[model samples]
Target chain A: EPEVTQTPSHQVTQMGQEVILRCVPISNHLYFYWYRQILGQKVEFLVSFYNNEISEKSEIFDDQFSVERPDGSNFTLKIRSTKLEDSAMYFCATRGQGRETQYFGPGTRLLVL
Target chain B: GESVGLHLPTLSVQEGDNSIINCAYSNSASDYFIWYKQESGKGPQFIIDIRSNMDKRQGQRVTVLLNKTVKHLSLQIAATQPGDSAVYFCAENIGTGGSYIPTFGRGTSLIVHP
Candidate 1:
């Protein structure tokens, strides 16, 4: 089964630095999303992307966050300035057209210090 | 519906036994639901789903039951194994006519003992 793929399985960055998390969804899927889970927390939606534009975003997805489909296969989330609270595991997901199932990637662990 | 805190409730079961995880959703408008299993170091994996119109749907070794009347949902695992030990979450979606995103439950940690 084809699955979503993410880069930098784990990352450590300094506070105030910029970080970008990357993902590659299943080749044929059309809807892509970014979600985050703080340690010992429920997974929360960050933003949903379709047709190169953001479909919806959560309140957590504030001014510091941005997402892009720079290429046919890559979806990325960038945080302009990191805060201590920004540390969490970020996951990417994709849902194909006509399919209700959304496949998730293993996730990228972001640690800010 | 109110957002829940991250302090997850947990359940323990022995290997080969059945395990049931329950959730009570507050939204009646939610017409779609999903169950996801997440490991210690991984993301949520899709397990099964049930539309509000259906009472039950079965996947490999897993069954999702929906009680729309009470806004309750449950996931039943048959012959549970150590591999089943993980945090399970219930997510609800109104779909908003294809406009709304899914709202996820706080999650429940399930531990299967050998």
Candidate 2:
């Protein structure tokens, strides 16, 4: 089965530095999303993207966060200034039309120290 | 609906036994729901889903039961195996104007012993 794929399985970055997490959603899916799971915590929604614009975002998705579909296949989340609290596992998900099932990618572990 | 802190509710079962995980959702307007399994060092994998109109839906070795009256959801696994050991989450799909975003609850950990 086709699955969502993400790059840089793990990343370590200094606080205050910029970080970009990349994902390639399933080719035919139209809706994409970003979610984060803090260690030992529930996964939280960050933002949802469709048609190259943000559909909805959580309060955690503040000024520092942004998402883009720079190409047909790539969806990325960029944090302008990483904070220690920003360290978490970031996951990318995609949903095709006509279905409620959203497939998730093996997450990118972001460690902002 | 959200799980905070370090302790996660855990269930332990013997291999080949059946396992059931339950969740109480907060959204009365949520019309769709999903179950996801996340192993250590991985993201949530879609297991099964059900709409508000359905009471139960079954997949290979798995079943999802929805009790809309009480806002409850449960995932049942038949013949559980070691590979089924993971954190299972229940999510509610809330949509408006044709857009849907899922909200996740703190997951319950399942441990299957050999």
Candidate 3:
């Protein structure tokens, strides 16, 4: 029953500030992903990471976003400049080798004012 | 340009009743599908999944039915309890090549009354 864990369950930041959301995926997972959901919208994919590199990213994952597995265990998503529209719930998901199921973390709620 | 969508926005059921949720996908290339439950303040939790090669799969008290021809998916919960109330979402993934990123649908809120 190992699950993904994220830090800073809730965060409120001012516009134009940089924010980094952290996640620690299951130890044996090989693929990691980031998704965001606006208050009343569907979950949107941001980016996917594997082998220390970005595998694929959506149009919303523009210049301001970057992901890193800096320590091999800590997967992080950083936003260079937060906008008011950036307010949403950011989720981290991981998939182990040979598995098609992606396990999700509790999520980090980000609010920009 | 792929999208997944739920047939209904909300469904209410009595405790101990069975509940069925439906989803439709616009992508014909999607080969893997998953159903997730999201309670308030929590992320989506995996409930069950089915591959394009299979038509049905069951887990615990849950069953997933997939129709490749019609591009439809449904999740069935037996003996639904009050704790089963949550927002459920269906996600589609194009498992072709090495890409496994999933596209999630708008969730359907399930309310179970005791």
The order by descending TM-score is 3, 1, 2
* Worst 10 contiguous positions by lDDT, candidate 3 chain B: B94-103
lDDT of 3 at B52: 91
TM-score of 1: 0.95
Q: For candidate 3, lDDT tens digit of each residue in A19-70?
A: 9999999999999999999998899999999899999999999999999999
Share of native interface contacts present in candidate 3: 0.89
* Cα lDDT computed for each candidate against the true fold: 0.88, 0.90, 0.94
Candidate 3 at residue B101, lDDT? 80
The order by descending lDDT is 3, 2, 1
- For candidate 1, what's the RMSD? 1.8
Local accuracy of candidate 1 as per-residue lDDT tens digits, B3-24? 4222338999999999999988
Identify the candidate with maximal lDDT: 3
Model 2, runs deviating above 4 Å: B1-8
Candidate with the larger lDDT of 1 and 3 = 3
Best-to-worst ranking by DockQ: 3, 2, 1
Deviation of model 1 at B29, angstroms: 0.5
TM-score of chain B of each: 0.91, 0.91, 0.96
CAPRI-style docking class of model 1 based on DockQ:
medium
* Pairs that collide, model 3: none
What shift in Å separates residue A36 of candidate 2 from its native position after superposition? 0.5
Q: Judged by DockQ, which candidate is best?
A: 3
